[model samples]
Target: MSVLEIRDLHASVQVSEDELKPILHGVDLTIRSGETHAIMGPNGSGKSTTAYAIAGHPKYKITSGSVTLDGEDVLSMSVDARARAGLFLAMQYPVEVPGVSVANFLRTAKTAIDGEAPKLRTWVKELRTSMEKLGMDPAFAERNVNEGFSGGEKKRHEIVQLELLKPKMAILDETDSGLDIDALREVSQGINRVKDAGSTGLVVITHYTRILRYVQPDFVHVFVAGRIVEEGGKELAEDLEASGYERFVNKVGA
Candidate 1:
């Protein structure tokens, strides 16, 4: 059964009347437990918007349709409620919280999501382990969140949160962007580690094929003009890598 379902979701960013508007139009997607789906799209496509909408960001209004988590109405939930319901989004550009320590931020997040306080000793141990798994220094937990972090460090930190929280469904929005080859491998390994723990579903939104090579998506989708135009198995990603999305673009009439 699908853990996450988006049915004909329509969303738009409210902008000036004269500006180009409406990001997602009738987008549909389903992700099940122990499955990984990759969404690839050209520039101006609504890949990130889809992820944000699933996470229930207030900025993007859902014009129509529904998003459900394990049959629960996700669209009706507040952002915090959605997080507590086991939905996570690792953003492309993570913002810095200068005053907040990584340990404090993660602990609070875990406490909120789990509806209880996590034991400090146990939580710190788990956080350190997750940090090590992502090739990050143990001392990183003591520093401010995302403050002065390099691009690779920011992505790795996001993975660290993913590991610590162990959300049932994780939406990785451009998690592979701006990382060097080693960092990319580390990030993919972290994702695989979580998947191996069972009952974890993934929706990876990306523009390039490099990360897919490591993560190995079960289903690959092509998003164009705010809609999923094509979907197939792993081979489709390889095909897109070789053919450069031209075929898919023509197929979508874009």
Candidate 2:
């Protein structure tokens, strides 16, 4: 099984050419294949910062600490290299690639990750099946990447990539943000399908526990002020949903 380990990861966001704003402070996390981890916190809690930093976003620089995927130095790899290493990030806002069709983008990404082109007939069938499973229309394959798509459609498309690429580990940043109830259920099912495959460890970052109801996390981490202050099982998410992060925030500020 694959393993991802984050050790005392401290990172800062580049505010200007010469300025860096620290976000994560000594964050540590570990996830194995077949496990789902949820990082929950209030706004500005460094949750997404952790995701982006681990995924090697240019704006977020790691000041100290190491991130390893299956014992390989993740921080040392380029963004594309990180992806080629079986790491995937479903951004909070998927960008719009106006000229590229969805089919082309997925196939190109899969080819890059696998280092080989998939057979055309097999690829076409798999792509259609994945889109249908995500409740997406077959016509979406012909549309430009996320161009003119609704919020729900964008999120569903990201999950479609997650399914098609089958990365070793995926970091989903606020995937539930713009989804309605029906859309949320469909997206969650897509996630669960990947989880059920018994590979592709998942790290879900969210402000609410709504998504957890469908994609239960094996571990729940309470992130506050750039650090994880509390950790527990699924029940911790329920408590946070009920009690809120007031106490945790107050404690961090205290």
Candidate 3:
């Protein structure tokens, strides 16, 4: 069974005068348990829009089609409800919340999604362990969320949340950007750890091939003009790497 399914999904963002316009057009995708899928495209291809739409971001309107989580209707649920239903999005640009400490944010989010507070002892221990696994300093937990964090640090924080929440399906929206070699390796290791826990699915959106070397996707999809136009195994990513997305852009009529 598919853990996440997006069938003929169409979404758009509103703007003055002529609406900003549809971003995703008839995108059909299915991610099963323990599978990792990569969507690669150039700028303005709607990869990030697909992630935000699935997570119920208010900016993206579901103009048509449907999204389901384990056969449950996701479009009918609120954003918070979507998170609670085992859907997680590690954003391309993680926003900073100045007043909230990382530890507090994780705890509150976990409690809200889990419908109960996590056991204090186990939660802290596991959180610390996960932090160490990501090569983050223990003191990071005390800092304000994403405040003063470098790009790599913010990306690592997203991985920290992924570890703590252990969502059934994680949509990583360009989590690879802005990382140095070492940091990318750490972040990729964190993702691998999450996959090792079992029954988890990953949808990783990236423009570069560096991160793919570590995480290794089961499928590669090419998005252009707000629609997926090509898909294949991992080699598709290598092909894009060798030849670039120009071929895909032409093929998709973008």
Candidate 4:
């Protein structure tokens, strides 16, 4: 079984020549394969910061701490290298690639992650199947990635990659953000499909408890001021929904 260990991870974003904005402050987390971890927090609590830092986005700098995938150093790896090593991030805002078709993008990403090209016939079939399962029109595959797509469509396409790429761990940043009710269910099912396969560890970062209803996370973490202040099971989510984050927010500010 694969394990991802984040120990005292402190990271910052370099916003200016002489200024570095601290985001993740001594965060520690550990998630294993087959485990679903939900990170719920108020905005600016460093939820997405943790996700981007883990994914090795150039904007975030890891000053002190360690991230390991089964004892292998993760912070040392380049962004693409991190991906090649089984880490995937479904961004809060998936970028629009104006020139790259979704079919080409998926295949190229798959090749990069797998170290070889997939046979066109089999790959096409797989891609078509994934798109259909995500409720995407087949023509969407021929269009430029995320361009001219609705917010919900972009989110759904991200899940299509998740289903096809099959990474060791996936960090989803607010995947439910712009999804409508039906789209929410569809995306949640796509996530559950990956989770049920027992291959990819899940770190679902969100601000609300709605997605948790369909995803059924095994652990819930309440992040505040860049640190996890509370950890519990599904009940914690229900509590947060009913009571909100005022208690935890006040504690963090106190």
CA lDDT of every candidate: 0.90, 0.97, 0.92, 0.94
Q: On residues 1-254, what C-alpha lDDT tens digit does candidate 2 reach at each position?
A: 99999999999999999999999999999999999999999999999999999988899999999999999999999999999999999999999999999999999999999999999999999999999999999799999999999999999999999999999999999999999999999999999999999999999999999999999999999999999999999999999989999999999999
* Model number with the top lDDT: 2
Alpha-carbon lDDT of model 4: 0.94
Comparing candidate 1 with candidate 4, which one achieves the higher TM-score? 4
RMSD (Cα, Å) for all candidates, in order, is 1.6, 0.6, 1.4, 0.8
How many clashes would you count in candidate 1? 0
**Sort by lDDT, best first: what order?**
2, 4, 3, 1
What is candidate 1's lDDT per residue for 43-107, written digit by digit as tens?
A: 87899989887887767779899999999999889899999999999999999999999999999
- In candidate 1, stretches whose alpha carbon ends up further than 4 angstroms from where it belongs are 17-20
Query: Any runs in candidate 3 off by more than 4 Å, and if so which?
Result: none
Pairs in clash, predicted candidate 2: none
lDDT of 3: 0.92
Candidate 3 lDDT, 100-203, residue by residue in tens: 99999999999998899999999999889988888899799999999999999999999999989988899999999999999999999999988877678999
- Candidate 1 matches the true fold with a TM-score of 0.96
Best by TM-score: 2
Candidate 4: give the clashing pairs.
none
Model 2: weakest 10-residue lDDT segment is 49-58
Off by over 4 Å in 4: none
lDDT string for model 4 (73-179, tens) is 99889889999999999989999999999999999999999999999999999989888888899799999999999999999999999999999999999999999
